[model samples]
Target: MTKKRKKEKFYVEEGETVADCLNRMAANGYQPVRRMEEPVLKEVKKNGKVDVEVSHQRIMFEGKLKEE
Candidate 1:
């Protein structure tokens, strides 16, 4: 039997830089391995509101890591 690895998530606050935040997390026992290497379905607009002109887009912001 094989053990399944659980996916981890780290939601950052608005106006937070992903790279900076990830680095901080890494120093504190959370080692960030890789970020979005593939495509994903996501929605983007001027803001939180989705735009009809450009519907959901393929995006990837996944930063894999293990928390201590």
Candidate 2:
């Protein structure tokens, strides 16, 4: 059988809560080791100028394989 990755990343999908993501990780035989949030950027044009702004935050979790 192929070996599974020791580390994996899980993202909180749209309309999904952080707790839901954690439960998903557990179901996949992984435990969360770290949590992170990255800003989703968007560009806006006003007065013939372009500006960048944060649209939202994307939540992610780094998971480690659970030991048997």
Q: What is candidate 1's TM-score against the reference?
A: 0.35
State the TM-score for model 2: 0.94
Residues 19-55 of candidate 1 have per-residue lDDT tens digits of 7667666654455554543333455576778754533
Candidate of highest TM-score = 2
lDDT of 2 by residue, 1-68 (tens): 78979999999999999999999999999999999999999999989999999999999999999999
Name the 10 consecutive residues with the lowest summed lDDT in model 2: 1-10
lDDT for predicted candidate 1 compared with the true structure: 0.50
TM-score of each predicted structure versus truth = 0.35, 0.94
